[model samples]
Target: MAEDFDLVKIMESGLEGAEYNKAKFPGLVYRIQNPKAAFLIFTSGKVVCTGSKSVENAHKAIITLANTLKDIGFDKIDLDPEVHVQNIVATADLKTNLNLNTIVMALGMENVEYEPEVFPGLVYRIDAPKLVVLIFSSGKLVIAGGKIPEDCEEGLRIISTEFDNLGLLS
Candidate 1:
């Protein structure tokens, strides 16, 4: 949930290392090293936490920031701010080399984008799990745009199933 924040008050309250320069950036940047997350706290109280390796870590970081805000005497801060995972970028390996041209041809032209001249990885967008996977020739895949961590695994499973059906796993 988003609430309004007095950025000036938060700044003057000695929030260690919290930077708020309206001219440079629109929101205040609060960083935590333990969970390895950075938050863009806006005047509208919209907190965008990034750089956390996992969903649990991101939630922990947000709670840490909220507690910090409360300790700074910010009454409007919610101790339990609702966190929404926008995207989860993850990587996986198929353990076998892939021929981009053949895979692209078999995967169909509707959901695949393989512009070798523009980018080396083949961009494959799946509608089921609703995520994008970048397939490389070296069997590495970078799955992005997932709302949850499971989405990445589901995408990989879907890819594996498709490849298996097409006899491309070998």
Candidate 2:
């Protein structure tokens, strides 16, 4: 059956507790904050993606997550289109810190219009709908505008949260 869901929500929410453990088993595993929404991806092409949400969203989330990994350049895995839903898990929002200016610099100024600040760092807009706040290497980002601050906050949050969940937070 075709899975139904807002892929962006699933991806955004799922990314909260997702992790990538290169040392543990040489692959990626997403331990969604929702206990029921957890899964493991082994380097050997074995996957155990389970969640207790609407069976449709659960399946959709897994596929969306899996595709995201692939897009992010994770090791190849033969994904089963017929994904199975074992349980549904409650959703939890994981906290994170994102430095938009730094990210923009990292991504290059070609994508943004750079503006100087007296406090240090830079500010820019994304697609004209989002305001990005960036600090020097030592500063944290403070973003405003857009549907929400997520676009700005997620970058840093993903790295830390993913590392933490992968048992590499230290």
Candidate 3:
């Protein structure tokens, strides 16, 4: 989070090559290449970090930003900022081809949406893990909207069990 950040001062400090264009975008886009993450720093002390493959990488990016700000004479930055994992996306392979039509019928209309002409995959919304899993005909699955890695794993397990019960696999 960018608490009361003076973007002008930060830009003048020349600590890092950060992209800031108030007229074009409200947030300062600071990118770190090591862990591969981009931080969107807004004037309202709101920061949104994205593109990190894992939560640890995200935390590293935030910490690095805070330290850089402090080193650049920005004193209001919190050394230990409160971090939260808003979402986690994961992918897996079921190892057997899926029949979208059959799986849709077995999983029920409310939870599954499959239109081959519009999309090649089926969108399966799972409630317990509170995430959406994309099931493809080639046995590929993409799980999204998970707060933690475990949530994604749990979602995969749940869906695998459901598919097994319905005999939808293969």
Poorly placed runs, candidate 2 (over 4 Å)? 1-16, 20-28, 32-36, 74-80, 85-170
Per-residue lDDT of model 3, residues 65-169, tens digit only: 888888999788888899988889999999998888888787789988899999999999999889999999899999999998999999999999999889876
Error of 3 at 16 (Å): 4.3
Comparison by TM-score, 2 against 3, better one: 3
Residues 111-145 of candidate 2: C-alpha lDDT, one tens digit per residue: 45455455555444445343343433343444443
Minimal lDDT window, size 10, model 1 = 1-10
Over 71-117, each residue of candidate 1 has an lDDT whose tens digit, in order, gives: 87877677898888999999999999999999988878999999999
Q: For model 2, how big is the CA root-mean-square deviation?
A: 18.2
lDDT-wise, the better of 1 and 2 is 1
- What TM-score fits each model? 0.86, 0.31, 0.87
Error of 1 at 9 (Å): 4.2
Cα lDDT, model 1, residue 76: 69
Superposing all C-alpha atoms, what RMSD in Å does each candidate have to the true structure? 2.1, 18.2, 2.0
